[model samples]
Target: MTNHTPPIIGLAGGIGSGKSTITKCFNNLGVQSVDADDVARLVVQPNSDCLNKIYQRYGEDILMNDGSLDRRSLRTIIFNRPEERTWLEALTHPAIKEEITSQLSKLTSKYALLVHPLLFETHQNAICQLVVAIDVPKEIQIQRVISRDNTDQESVEKIISTQLSNSERIHRANLILENTGNIDEMNAKVFKLHQNILELISC
Candidate 1:
């Protein structure tokens, strides 16, 4: 990979808004992506300092039999208590940001896709030359999360409620990609947007 630090294009979306699918489409076009969610997972892996800190705070109950973080259980706790969520974010955000920067630095693409649900929330948009927000209907987001995670509608709603509203995200984004259609339609939209981003960045 090139050591060149390319311009970043941040991707933002609510839970289950198909950001991953869109990232995959960008990857197919040879654009490397650095996913904050994936980095978040990495920073808290079993035996990591972040995980050890979490275990100290929340106890072994938050750990699986194999010693990995029990994410679903932890999610329930944090979502129910805003204070706990704040504490967790305080503990993990810096580590995740560091990892994301390290990964983006190694990408060979002309521009790097930074896929982060909290791109704007965490002020990560500051690092991006442009930001794209995926806009999906709230109902569709709930349905997709329920189907994909085998989660309940209420839980999905709670997650969505914590995120920026669709209109707010659209207002903040440099561009918006609507994703309420079929897979083929989404792919087409992603391809077109990919070209547009390339053109914009080249100028």
Candidate 2:
């Protein structure tokens, strides 16, 4: 890595808004990205301290037969109980943040993409030089999440309800990418935005 740290560009979007797809497009253009969701999973690997604490709190029922966290079960629990969600966030956020920082520092790209679903909600936008918000219709988001996760409409809608609305996210973002089209179109949008980002930061 160079002595001068590359600017971090944050990617923000609601569930199933195609953040991962966009990240892949940036990766194809040689931009390295640190995904908070990936970091969150790493912090809770079977024998890790975070996982151990979670097991102690939620008991063995939360673990799969293979000993990994049963994410779907835990997701149901947290979504139904707001207090439990808060407790889980308190336990996990700092570790996630630390790992995100460590991973971001190792990147040698012109700009690092910090892919986070709750970029603004978690105040992670503060660390970013710019933020790109992925905008999709509410119905599309619901349908995509349900189809992708094999979850029900109510569950998908509940998750979306917890996130900032598309308008709010767009208002807060430095750039917006609407994802109502097919993958090829989305890829083109991402490539165009990637070049725009390079130009913005260069100036």
Candidate 3:
């Protein structure tokens, strides 16, 4: 089937940079949004093949008593080991991408706001007509992650290490939504950028 319109707006940013907030704002505007995080969660849901593979590969250490994936423990295991991280990524990303592609195939909107922490890193940015990065200073990023994830500096730093830097993210994005401002100000910025995006595809 031919799509009437394809996904166009991609939101990529560090863990605590408010990409989800911006995506929600767009959703309120009637745009369908696809979340890579949600997609990732589906990939590892209980009793899923991916979960079985992970259990077999990583052993039973990552499972909870309730038969669900212990995401935190799994994260700790992969955080310090590059080979294990790569192995897990290899196992999950393809399935995640397949599911996302199926979802996108059915999307009928001027654009879909695709929220991904590592959208660019996966070579998926090539499909997005425009990318918006909700930018924050590094100091703020570190603090936000530590606060939001309730993790210490060392773990937060390791997570950040896996992601691209602020300058690098800005360099790769077509637009930057700097969120250092107040809520009202940030809302205004998001609205303006939304308008600009509408104009871009309209032209």
Candidate 4:
């Protein structure tokens, strides 16, 4: 890699919209990636400071019998109540941001992808040189989530309702990838974008 700073590309999409699928495409092309969701999960591991704070606030019921967080219960709480979501974000977003920054700094790839569902929501998009929004129809998103996660439609809809609308995400992004359920097509699109990113960065 050149001494020039590697460009950070933020990948944004709704739940089940296949952000990870495209991130994996970039990974296959030799780019490194940092996922905010993965970072969030890491920060809340059992015995971690974040977990301790959460337990303090919400009490032992928020934990599983194994002592890990009861993520499903917490998800239900936050999605149903806006104030709870705000409180949770205030507690976790900063730590997630710090971890993401540190992870990005250590990447040696020509370009890096930061995959975040809340890229625009949490203002994390500001750290990215560009953002790619994966565009999938709402029905497709709901279907995919139900099929892949075995989740109910109501829960999926509730999650989707919390996120930026398709138009809003597109408005905030530099590029858009329409995911129509064809893996090969998506791969081709990502590969082209990868090459384009490399060329642009090399300049």
User: Best candidate, lDDT-wise?
Assistant: 1
Q: Model 2 segments beyond 4 Å from truth?
A: 1-3
| lDDT tens per residue, model 3, 1-203 | 24564756888988878777777777776788889999999999998989999989877788998888999998998997889999999999999888877777778767778788998888778778899887898888889888888889888888888988888989999998898877678778878988899899787
> Candidate 4: where is the Cα deviation over 4 Å?
1-5
180: Cα error in model 1, Å: 1.1
Instruction: Give the per-residue Cα lDDT of candidate 4 at 201.
Output: 65
List ranges where model 1 is wrong by over 4 Å. Answer: 1-3
Clashes of each: 0, 0, 0, 0
Write candidate 2's Cα lDDT for 38-105 as tens digits. Answer: 99999999899999998999998899999999999899999999999899999999999889988898
Weakest lDDT window of 10 consecutive positions for candidate 2:
1-10
Q: Distance (Å) between predicted and true CA of 178, model 1?
A: 0.7
Query: What is the lDDT, from 0 to 100, of the residue 187 in candidate 4?
Result: 88
The better-scoring model by lDDT among 1 and 4 is 1
Q: Model 4 over residues 1-203: C-alpha lDDT tens digits?
A: 23443688899999989988888888998999999989999999999888999899899889999999999989988998899989998999989998988888888888889999989999989877888898889999999899998889999999999899988999989888899958899889999888777776677
Poorly placed runs, candidate 3 (over 4 Å): none
Give TM-scores for every candidate, taking all chains together and pairing residue i with residue i: 0.97, 0.96, 0.94, 0.94
- Each model's C-alpha lDDT? 0.93, 0.92, 0.84, 0.89
Give the Cα error of residue 102 in candidate 2, in Å.
0.3
lDDT by residue for model 1 over 1-203, one digit each (tens)?
24479989999998999988889889998999999999999999989999999999999899999999999999999999999999999999999998998899988888999999888999999999999999989999998899999999999999999989999999999999999888899889989999999999999
